[model samples]
Target: MCTYLKNMANYKHSHLKNKSFEEIQMLFNNTLKWIESFVPMDTELVKGSEKVAKGCSKRATYKLEQEDAKRQRIEEENESVE
Candidate 1:
């Protein structure tokens, strides 16, 4: 199917080289209709996709503070050496 679309696109580009933008858009939309004929329409909204934990924000802030403290310590040590 992907190969077919690629070949069709090449064919369209070769044949419609002189066509206007509107004509090209219409041809592209018509080509997409073939995909719709093969694939079923997904109308339902996806539910319950909770990716983050409850304390994720707190943990992230703590991690950022730890990294900042480490960076500050490194800078302080470098300044003392100089």
Candidate 2:
């Protein structure tokens, strides 16, 4: 179970790495809302599902932070060349 969640987080981070922060937040919020829509009122299957979702969200944010630093460095180099 732990390994599965870690792989999921890694996949999500790879997929979301290129997205802007706003887009990432929007996707994360939508995912949570979708999960919430399946709450116990209909079925108990969604219990504790937020853990994986939050894990994915954190990974996505980390990926974007890493990419932001690289992007800024490239932009700085370009500006210095001008």
Candidate 3:
């Protein structure tokens, strides 16, 4: 379980590199929680559960990015600190 979560966190960090560090971290954590709540507990393998996983990741990402519209502008303008 630890390894799985670690890998997911790493993937989230890399996948959402465009996002701020804090936002990615929060989203990554929330993703793990979402999996726990939405995924079936009977199995560890994520086979055939791609939709749930993707939905969770998208939701987490969307939640963070939506709240920080100015952050996107700052990043696009190559400014550091928002």
Question: For every model shown, what is its TM-score relative to the native structure?
Answer: 0.36, 0.45, 0.29
Each candidate's lDDT (Cα)? 0.66, 0.67, 0.68
Candidate 1 on 1-82: residue-level lDDT in tens? 3344457655544566676778767767778886565633343222222225436777899999999999999999999999
What C-alpha lDDT, on a 0 to 100 scale, does residue 42 get in candidate 3?
A: 57
- Model 3 scores a TM of 0.29
Q: In model 3, what is the error at residue 61, expressed in angstroms? A: 41
- lDDT by residue for model 2 over 1-82, one digit each (tens)? 2233224333355666677778666666666576566657335455457668889999999999999999999999999999
Deviating ranges (above 4 Å) for candidate 3: 1-15, 39-82
Worst 10 residues of 1 by lDDT: 42-51
* Shift in Å, residue 51, candidate 1: 12
Report the candidate with higher TM-score, 1 versus 3. Answer: 1
Question: lDDT for model 2, on a 0 to 1 scale?
Answer: 0.67
Evaluate residue 36 in candidate 3 and report its C-alpha lDDT on the 0 to 100 scale. Answer: 70
